[model samples]
Target: MKKKSTHLRALEGKSKSEKKKIRKEFEEVKERLEKAQAKYVQKPKRQKATTSKAENKKWEQKRKDRYNQRVWKGWRDKDMEEYPVKTYNIKDIEKDT
Candidate 1:
């Protein structure tokens, strides 16, 4: 049988010190989590106003109609042939050698 490498043997079974340290760390984390959960347990339940499906549909339709009306009002009788031109030039400057 081949002899096990030191790294494999060390990692396969943790020493007592390493186990105790890991357990302590886990316990501390658990304690913190419990405290955090306890702190949030008494928080006020938010009363979100629930609108009905019909009301939601009505609101969405009203918004869409308003948007369409505004778009039609903005573009009606506007000249489609006259597009604006860019007024500035963006040429790269020559670098001094």
Candidate 2:
């Protein structure tokens, strides 16, 4: 069987200068990537919300007014003129309870 070469074995153990060169190259590559990323990254545009406070307040007021009008209409329809007021004694309710 053939034996492995000494040069290949020597290449497995890097010299001090070779290690330093590799470390410096890695550092340079990292710095270059950081600079390129900084240049390419973009800021997002601002978005406006759908419902502003003033519009919400206006809608809420209109809803409340509509609810109040419906309640008033029912009260008027039930009690205004055609339907006569009926009186009941409190004792009758207590007896039923």
Candidate 3:
């Protein structure tokens, strides 16, 4: 059999009234710990509703306006330029090669 700890031996030597007081304090601490844990437990958050057709259209228009503003700003800052499209004939290039 395992030997009892010194603390256990000391506790065993205490009077009944002292033991009862210690037991009551232990119960109170246990109850308090349970209450604290319950208080901190996370609740599920409510989800947002899906956007309606009108809301989606509004968002799309806002996006287009934002893009146009950015393009205009770039043109004003001389950061935007227009280039002419160049077309190539594959047969003509092959004949040259």
Candidate 4:
């Protein structure tokens, strides 16, 4: 990796080998994301439905949304694994006021 700029977040104070491993894992995730995204070449067009059909579709949509939330959580968990962090103290944060 190139010498990091001051603006970037430093690794979790781990050894260079461990940091490299994390970086490799993240790169793999990025590649997998790119490959998965390639399957969707264009935006999905929504279909218009009648009143009752729309009502039933709404419940099905809620179900799909709940399933997608788990996928979102999986992505978040992978990110935190690579950049495992410690909580900051209030004093450490710069005040905006």
For each candidate, what TM-score against the reference? 0.31, 0.46, 0.36, 0.33
Q: Number of clashes in model 1?
A: 0
Q: Candidate 4 on 1-97: residue-level lDDT in tens?
A: 8877532345567788977887887789989999999988787889876569778999999999998777667766888643344587787686633
> Model 4 segments beyond 4 Å from truth?
1-10, 42-97
Worst 10 residues of 4 by lDDT: 3-12
Lowest-lDDT window of 10 residues in candidate 1? Answer: 81-90
After superposition, candidate 1 runs with Cα above 4 Å error? 1-12, 43-97
24 Cα displacement, candidate 2 (Å): 3.6
Q: Give the TM-score (vs. native) of candidate 3.
A: 0.36
Error of 4 at 80 (Å): 94
For candidate 2, which ten residues in a row score worst on lDDT?
A: 3-12
Which has the higher TM-score value, candidate number 1 or candidate number 2? Answer: 2
Candidate that would win on TM-score: 2
- Model 3 scores a C-alpha lDDT of 0.79
lDDT of 3 by residue, 2-92 (tens): 9896545655978989878877877799899999999999999998879988999999999999988776776656744442334789998
Number of colliding residue pairs in each model: 0, 0, 0, 0
Error (Å) of candidate 3 at residue 93 is 82
TM-score of candidate 2 on Cα atoms, chains taken together: 0.46
What is the per-residue lDDT of model 2 for residues 1-97, given as tens digits with 9 covering 90 to 100? 8876654444457997876776687779989999999998998989899999999999999999998777677767877853244678999989999
- N/CA/C clash count, model 4: 0
